[model samples]
Target: MTAPGRIGIDMVPFTRVRALLGGGLLAGRMLSADERRLLLDGDEPDVPGIAGRLAAKEAVFKLFHATGETVPWQGIEILRAESGAPWVRLSGRAAALARGAGIGSVSVSITHDEPCAVAVALTAPDSEERSAP
Candidate 1:
């Protein structure tokens, strides 16, 4: 079982996100379809939004605590709630890594200021871990 209170945080600059969007490749590689729709469907470039999502993804990846594995960038989805709050959904390698790490759920918070976006992720113990005999 893993220890309690596992947390991860990351920060991303809006300028970097803008550069990635301008490059076009990293944006496609990093963002999920739904995220793309919400962030990229707009007329103007959503630099802060993209930066927040990137920060969120990096933050989520840190929770896995796995070494020698590449971060499954697109496999970590950051979705918005009806209230416009951000949430996390993991798939593929990200989900498997979380399971192996004894993580059940991850809660994320994102905020953006003038130049950068910041995100923090907190993990809950897995059901099996909590219920283990």
Candidate 2:
């Protein structure tokens, strides 16, 4: 059974994402079919700046078995620290749920390759090691 202090991790391959979102890319400045073509022809795939963040949110939901309620998208945002360490941005209802769940901290890792992006999330219980006799 899932516990209050349980931690979960999930991974998504870049190729899969590319296949899914490739067609969605239209001719545009931000991202377009031409860009997709270039990506397909080139060695590296170019994922949008926001793709990683979006995937991270989904990954967080998966890890927690939460439907964006306890940890809504608005609550969890991906950010890059000065050291280039990616982290989450918690706020609003999402932050409240995390606190109530006794979550001391949460960590996320995100990577992007072309069309698809992968993300990992880790949640730690507020307290570890119950009081022992």
Candidate 3:
């Protein structure tokens, strides 16, 4: 069996995200092109969706445990599978952090309500760890 993985959860208020996204720069900095497309393709009133994505990113960031490092927001790309499930793609420093932490695949789940959004991230142990039995 695989080793138990790390879990991270975060919640974000829609209004807060809305204000950040209003400047547009934060959205560009935080989201990948595909993620931005997904946000735009979503239904009207995009604040909740943005908040959901932001929360997902924050949740994934927590899994890294990079205490003194700056959050590589763009490196942790949160995307959707064909089945509409949330998946994580790590790159750059985020990938390095995951490797350092023995994190393999990262999965995320996001939900939105009127006022806020919440997300949870789970990081699977690396293959070597899984094979260590």
How well does each candidate superpose onto the true structure, as a TM-score? 0.90, 0.55, 0.84
lDDT of 3 by residue, 1-133 (tens): 3226689999999888777767876556887777778776556537777788889988988987879987788888877777777778888999898777767777789999989999998877555322211
lDDT for each candidate structure: 0.85, 0.54, 0.78
Q: Deviation in angstroms for 69 in model 1?
A: 1.5
lDDT of 2 by residue, 1-133 (tens): 1235455454445554455556653222222233245333455554443466556766666554555454365556566566666666565666666566556556778777665577777774545321211
Candidate 1 accuracy as TM-score: 0.90
Candidate 1 Cα misplacement greater than 4 A, ranges:
1-3, 125-133
> For residues 14-118, what per-residue lDDT tens digits would candidate 1 score against the true structure?
889878878896557998898898788889868888899899999999998988999798999898887788878888999899989878888889999979999
Which stretches of model 3 miss by more than 4 angstroms?
1-3, 41-45, 127-133
Give the candidate number with the greatest TM-score: 1
TM-score of 3: 0.84
Better of 2 and 3 by TM-score: 3
Ranking by lDDT: 1, 3, 2
* Runs with alpha carbons beyond 4 Å of true place in candidate 2: 1-47, 67-71, 125-133
Q: Candidate 2 versus the native: TM-score? A: 0.55
The count of residue-pair clashes in candidate 2 stands at 2
